[model samples]
Target: MMNRFICIPLCLFLLSVCNPKKNERPNGWYYITDRVEDSISLEPIVTINDFEEIKLDSAENLKGKFIYQITGHVAADCVEKWADATEHSIGKRIGFVFQDEVICTPCINCRIETGSFAISAQDTDIKSIYWQIVRKIHSR
Candidate 1:
């Protein structure tokens, strides 16, 4: 079952905390700001950059398939689109880009009121971007 998100400010926390296996993150992951663009307009919106790296944890939740988890300080505005399924929610999708490349265009699933989420790719295309995040982590 999915959990409902409750917002609290002033705390730098993650909803789900799972360390990467052996503390080793694979290639192509990245760290980015939550300031997302409207999927349609592509206009920028000021958003929270409170989160950290997104990693592939386990496949159990995904029918034994691997998926990337975006865990860290989630921002309220980042997930507002998934809070309800109203007219605004209708036909709404969350678009993510890494250095001008599209990461995901997932349909609004649920409110990420907490500060963590996972992205499951229909194809292995995300593998390419995973290394970008790995490089970002290593450079730090």
Candidate 2:
């Protein structure tokens, strides 16, 4: 009887230890200024804590379409420069990568700025990718 009682508590402890909480930091992509020395180079501009909320949802009136939305405010300090960079970044690939092996690349066509942003890919499953991103980042 005592062994059974101890085993239950032990199992609970194991579960708690195994399922640790996720970090407060979020992992995702952002737009940044393009730099040039002799040649133009695309630089990933990071906005710290840019995402106030991230969510998964189905596209309205678009059957079988899924979207991931990020809502936040843009940097008020660099509006014009940010706008220019965003325009330059169109038709480019969007990514959030820590290393070569770990990354998420989403299709991007429009500018990234303040307010709400949504990402969806016709060639790839963004919902699946989004979940993978959440798991990969939250697991750390």
Candidate 3:
């Protein structure tokens, strides 16, 4: 009977150690401002934690096809940094990376100042990626 009681607590402890807690810090996700051929910058302009909130949703594109949108709200303290990066990156290619893997390299079309950013992708499964990112943002 004593062994059974000890085993129950031991199993619970093992489960807690093995499972990822919701509040745990997530792995690295980066915004790359520079890239050369297949290699991206080792220094990230911003990390996923810079965002206060991140969400995942689907929307219809001009072609009437459904696509995924991952929208983020820059933390107030990081708004200046985010704005400057976007402004300087206009008409230039930038990248989003997760765990050293390139997620997307899109050209910035304009300067964004609203403290919000949206990343939209077509012909890809963004749902999984979005969830991974959203799980990292504490305010999400």
Q: State each model's CA lDDT, in order.
A: 0.42, 0.49, 0.69
Count clashes in each candidate, considering only residues at least 3 apart in sequence or on different chains. 11, 0, 0
Candidate 1 lDDT, tens digit per residue, 15-111? Answer: 2334332322222223332456422333432122323445644344546756554433334554443233222333456545455544555554444
Output the number of the lDDT-best candidate: 3
lDDT against true structure, model 2: 0.49
> What does candidate 1 score on TM?
0.42
In candidate 1, residue 57 scores what lDDT?
Answer: 49
Residue 104's lDDT in candidate 2: 43
Better of 1 and 2 by TM-score: 1
**Per TM-score, what order, best first?**
3, 1, 2
* Candidate 2 pairs with clashing backbones: none
Give candidate 2's TM-score: 0.37
Of 1 and 3, the candidate ahead on TM-score is 3
lDDT of 3 by residue, 1-140 (tens): 99999999999999999996543223333344444643555556677877777788787879997788787787898888777877888887667666555667777887777767766656556788777777766454
Measured over all alpha carbons after superposition, the RMSD of each candidate to the real structure, in angstroms, is 20.3, 11.5, 8.3
